[model samples]
Target: MHNQIDQAAGLRKLKKNKPVRVIAITSGKGGVGKTNLSVNLGIAMAQKGQRVALLDADMGLANVDILLGLYPKFNLSHVLTGEKKFG
Candidate 1:
């Protein structure tokens, strides 16, 4: 169909293995849905076959691990305290 051709023509292939893109979700105050939104957004992107990394840089709460139900065996704190090394 002509519609299918038009839709296919509109698509341009992206360059593979380029530098990683980062999406930072930040807010001034606390107790909003920033963590929830960022977590879901990252999941959605990964589900669509796009590589995704969500860094929880919130210095105060540091609850992204909790939202993801992940209890990391080692965190940056461990690295900073010479308890673990980045490999």
Candidate 2:
């Protein structure tokens, strides 16, 4: 009974979804430091315990992963293809 009650409360919390803030950094030229700014800002926010998702969709400058030096086994591509589940 206690476990079921706890799950019901957790579901309530999830239903009260928080507002999301999306920040995009863009530029038309290279060597303008957009990557550095985005990475640093994301790190600072994460340090403050804020959820941050940095989307580096620019193929020409897809360096967020490289800048953070993170070589993750899975990526957005895997998630999109249903190879992995979010949960």
TM-score top scorer = 1
**lDDT of each model, Cα atoms only?**
0.69, 0.71
lDDT of 2 by residue, 1-87 (tens): 553323234335544697567688888887799989999999999999998778676645466789999886766565445565442
lDDT of 1 by residue, 1-87 (tens): 653323212112222436456577878887778999999999999999997767676656688899899997766565555565443
Tell me how far the alpha carbon of residue 65 in candidate 2 is from the true structure, in angstroms, after superposition: 1.0
**Which 10 consecutive positions of candidate 2 have the poorest summed lDDT?**
2-11
| TM-score list, all predictions | 0.65, 0.63
Badly placed stretches (over 4 Å) of model 2 are 1-16, 74-87
Q: Which clashing pairs does model 1 show? A: none
